[model samples]
Target: MVKFEYAPAPESTAVVDIAPSYGLFVDGAFVDPADGEPFKTVNPATEEVLCEVVAGGPADVDRAVQAARRAQDGVWSRLPGRERGKYLFRIARIMQERARELAVLETLDNGKPIRESRDVDVPLAAAHFFYHAGWADKLSYAGFGPDPKPYGVAGQVIPWNFPLLMLAWKVAPALACGNTVVLKPAETTPLTALLFAEICQQADLPPGVVNIVTGAGETGRALVEHDGVDKVAFTGSTEVGKAIARSVAGTRKRATLELGGKAANVVFEDAPIDQAVEGIVNGIFFNQGHVCCAGSRLLLQESVADEVLDSLKRRLGMLRVGDPLDKNTDVGAINSAAQLARIRELSDIGEAEGAQRWSPACELPDRGYWFPPTLFTGVSQAHRIAREEVFGPVLSVLTFRTPAEAVEKANNTPYGLSAGVWTEKGSRILWMADKLKAGVVWANTFNRFDPTSPFGGYKESGWGREGGRHGLEAYLHG
Candidate 1:
């Protein structure tokens, strides 16, 4: 039989209309920052500058917070839940209408595969709005107590991995709860958020109800430390989360932080080998393993360790890593040079610490930030790679002799965001779920997310939750 291969199926970039430069989305309009210096956001795939965006300083943040507060007091807070729901529904519908453009833009800006951006990120974002729209008029039935009140203005900071999705996760719930917001998209991935600002306007959302401030760490710090913000929601590094926690320590503000994770994908000896292998690949390789809840730690039963490793390696060899715009690409570019350097640093340290590192034979683009799917077979709990969050397409394998040992090893890390278990036995699955100390536990699947399900973390991973009715509480008070 002749071998057949897919041709390059690249998505058209003509759908997205990017501006030469962008200003901060304040109140209801795009305005230049007061004292902020401008910076260019580049595509990590080719190191090409995409566009210049204003860096929001304390003054711009204050402006945004004041606008949000004014909107909360003047219009949003007084609006009926049914009326607010209509706005959210309109936003969701408009997002659906512009879904293709949004997906292509996300792939270009974020350097994630087009398929994932199109299928997962864009749709889930719209789903959040749709889900929250339905919940807006039903908050009384929610268990958060009757006569729930909006928190006025919420300050939100999101990471680069899922720009539009995180914005939807924060903004949708806050707006649905009748609160206005000031959102800070990651400096590297602000395109979609800026585009979403246009969507809010298209939906005829009231001015100041949804504000997006784009910049680097300093801007995010300003938003987090702003005095006018009644609630703070952040999704990023654990270090930043701790700082925000301290920033609001003595204030009247409430915060929900979704931080880092070093999750374990536990595979039992009785697991269906083929299915388990698939989950193993999906858990760590999806989004180039930039996921906060990525299963970077692979806990295999010693009995089937060799078999699983063999299968996993074979499966990884088949992963296609190339242009983000290509529909056939399984993996794409890393978000930035800094992230690539960090991944390389941790990977080198893993090798120095005596873990047997292995990667499939694959060619990476010379110009872009890329790392092949890699695994360290001789890794142990003591290994740095096994303990710390690599935040890349890297997996550290550790073996467990028994069920109890697997649970102990899985929960050993300080980060307790998520964990996965694969076993043929139903009793074993439940036992593992109960035993594992994590906020989200998946039994047979991995990297699965739903807008209606509440997601957050334990310990240093995060505080509070986002998604579902649980997410609304952070933006409201009884």
Candidate 2:
């Protein structure tokens, strides 16, 4: 095999203009909160301060919720389905027009590769709007009965892993269903959300139709608890999801929570070695494994486990883990210092619990948060690493002797978000998919997503779907 070297291809950051400070986006205007100081957002890769943003408090949440309520009752609710779709279409076009700027800003704040931010995140965000735009006028045919009604004002909170993409997932469907929204982006990655607020203004969307509040957990709590909010949607840890569930229990408000996962990627003895190796690498390393449904557990049939591990290791050795702006960088920086600390702690526990850890020969930068692609072998289902959501570029290797045993090991977890199977036999693919207790199952691939597919989880992975037609129904009551 020939080893090829490439030149540095860094993306230009001149495209995006970041102000020294920003305020809460409320009622189609930027306003200062009544209390709380401004908080600084930084580039995780360089530890450089990107910008300072206002920290919205309970009062701000109330104001935003009231704004959404006003929009839902006034302009947005009275607007016809076709007119609503026209607005969505306009927003979609504006997002595409500024795609490069959004992608660069996302890379600066979130520490994901510019290649991914440009190619995957921005494009998919626009796709969600485009996909949902077509469904706007035709929503009566969405199988929710003839006269499905909107849920008034939706209060949404999203995580930091895929900030822009998650916003698209939650906002597009809610808007398409005629529900105005007050959305809170995770404190760590709020730039793109703020930028989206500008996009809403550029599209000339009616006032109060979309509100963005920038804050921490307390702000999210306020939004979830606000009486003016008719619905709630949260994407984060299971602990927080449980709290949100309890907060809205037996209430008139509706809620959808998409939480954590410890997904398993199973490889059979008859699977193609090269493709399986690629799938295994992609499962746990893409976006530095920050995905909620990432394939962190690799279960191999014992008959060929050694050979598969060798191939996987060789492939990981070639992965480039460096500057996110570089087009050739395969893996990028961790999202934040706290997340990096958590990954380190869990990995140390895995080592202490008798797992053999290994990584490719690589040098890490000293300035910022970074983690090499790591794998632990001789791991069992009983190990904490196999059961926990590490949410970083870490893989735990486990082996089973039979198909029934594989099923047993995969289903032993508390999460049922997703699982993957790799085998050539069509019959085996169908059989294993049937046995896996997950919301989404993939054959010979992992981590592939689309706007047309419904994505969610079972068990502690949380409730309700977030894509396709099922996502639209989550915001409707009648």
Candidate 3:
């Protein structure tokens, strides 16, 4: 068991130069927005203003897009594969050296627990860069013809949940495939990505290879719809993803989306109850359930529901909830006020739809957005909680009698992004793995990710993979 050290929570300060309220990173340098409009980015835990970030309007995105075009035309696209690989290796090394600072920045900007930002997000982000760098010179083995070429100026829009990690997932492969990039981080969580621009400069990467534009939905639309961009990669709500799909339709733009999911984590009677309970907790509440592939549904065998719930509830009660920077905190504040309301509205819908609701007995922060770890029992396949992606630390519990029933319940949702199975029987694990339609399946373990693994949905979850050799194809075309 990992013992979380309790430390005194620190107060918020507005004037710390430790992190910058950055502008758009254009041509290896930070530049002010063309419109001169700036927005304040706040620390969600205390609602303290962290920095005044420049909001990229259409003109700023055009500048960024044009810069990316120039970089792709002049340098990155024509660079030798080995040289590109070396740049990625340098960035990966820099990421590892500065991992701690990036983690704190991610937690401060995105409102996830510090432990996750440190242990999961930062390391995985670096690993992604390392893994993809190895593939730069070996694109011939990637099964996409003998000679694959980079798609110039990829316009990638990533989510607030895993800012730095998602940036690596998108940027690493694009760089590996020899594409310049103009990425827009989520409005709520753009700090770590902006900080990454400094890492690029430190690595001595050429100008316009990466540009970070910070703003809301309108900014994302401006980027994707812009003619200068050759490809669009997005990770966010399904509604917005579909809108992007429609916007890019009839155009020659290459697009890929890693959207929302309502993943099910099944615990069988033969499973280790304690371990499964912990996996369940980690799966759903790791980032306060702000994950796209979060195991929001729990399908327990009828014979062991009581024992599993007992173990789960006991474990839930012991979780520390407070300031994100506190190492002891298991549950942190919601990313934004909008997300908190969505969680609340969904939980209320679960209750109104006749599902029993339960939350961990814990106090939330007095300021900023907060929601306790929640669970809903009596959730049928028809329940709103079962069907909808309540992207919060809320779990929906359902029961099943047989393996067939378990698979049936697990595959009931439109999303096939991810699923988890906990069982002592090896045969059952294999059987369930074949049956589940999710892009990624976890047998016993949940929410585990590696840089070399392929991750994407099979159905409405979206098309294409984000890691492994397959991830390179999205940015490549001969």
Candidate 4:
């Protein structure tokens, strides 16, 4: 018999010593907001005041843009691509060194399970830097012109879900390609990104190479509309993505949007039943189904629908949901009150729209914002649950008589960021992969991501890839 010892989840007693106020990062140092207004970032899980961060209005945005513009016109853009690659390499190494601390902060601020922050989120963030670092100097061979230039200054806005990882995705490649960045992390989860600002300083990255301005939608609007920025990258909702597209239309600022998704994980009759059950759990319940590419819809072959559903419910029943810091916890609190409301409203709509709703029989914590892992059966293509991005631990189950119907119903949504096909048949897997309209399709798996693989969507899911060689293109100008 083999024995394994598990380490207890680490705890942080050091009070989050966010100064009475945090200022915007400009020219490699923290400074007051140009507009002189500030906002407090709160811990959604406990509704506690985490810190007061700078609320950058138009003036602050202008200053941040000016800083970025200067860096692009001066040292950062002038640095050799190989040297830029070295900077990214150092950031990646530091990210690994600080993974545990970042994971704790992530769980505290964003209310996601620490296991995911430590195991999935932090590691992949570093991997993204590692993966893109190699491409900094090899841009000429990446299908672009032999001498691709950097987009002057990238104005980036990222969502609260996976805060640090989004920062890595947006900033790493921009830095690797020699473009300075003005990044606005989502208001609710600004802690990690602000900490990342500290890491930039520790790595000795050039001032203005990366800047963090923390605020709400208005902050994002200022950054996007700033004429000095050359490109804009946003990751959030479909409605917001379209609005951004319209906002930047006819402007010199090129934009890429990685928006919402209602991905389908299809289980054919031949799928490994046990494996499919686990995949289904991970697809929808992982991160409390806050994932944009969550398998919100489960398209099971009619023959095995009952069997798969039974097994899935059984597996879901065993999941532990509680404190995010507990390594054994499988799910965590909803990121915010607004997100919880949205999930509840949509789940209510699912029931009103005549789909049968089911949740595991578990006693949820009375304090933090929480939702039980939920599923809807008898869902039709016309139901709101089937069409809308619930973006919670909610799954809609529908059956298909044939593979064509599976693909049809899977791609029926306006968004198509990702999808999954589960089957033992090699030909069926390939055929399904070819027919699916999503940007990422997993065969015999669901919700698996690698830094080296490209990720994004086909339609309303948004444009441009996030990882891999293709990600570098977003920062380069012809």
Of 1 and 3, which scores higher on TM-score? 1
Whole-model lDDT for model 3 versus the true structure?
A: 0.89
Cα RMSD of all models vs. native, in order, equals 1.2, 0.8, 2.1, 2.5
Model 1 spans with C-alpha error above 4 angstroms:
1-4
Candidate 4 local lDDT, residue 455: 88
- TM-score of model number 1: 0.99
The collision pairs in model 2 are none
Model 2 off-target regions past 4 Å? 1-3
At residue 123, what lDDT does model 3 achieve?
91
Model 2 over residues 122-195: C-alpha lDDT tens digits? 99999999999898888889999898889899999999999999999999999999999999999999999999
Between candidates 2 and 3, the one scoring higher on lDDT is 2
Candidate order by lDDT, highest to lowest?
A: 2, 1, 3, 4
Q: How high is the lDDT of residue 292 in model 3?
A: 93
lDDT of 1 by residue, 291-322 (tens): 99999999999999999999888888888888
lDDT of each: 0.93, 0.94, 0.89, 0.88
Point out where model 3 deviates above 4 Å.
Answer: 1-21
- Location of the lowest summed lDDT over 10 successive residues in candidate 2: 1-10
Q: How much does candidate 3 score in TM-score?
A: 0.96
Tens digits of per-residue lDDT for model 4 on 372-456?
Answer: 9999999999999899988889999999999989989998989989999999999998999999999999988788888888889
Candidates by TM-score, descending order:
2, 1, 4, 3
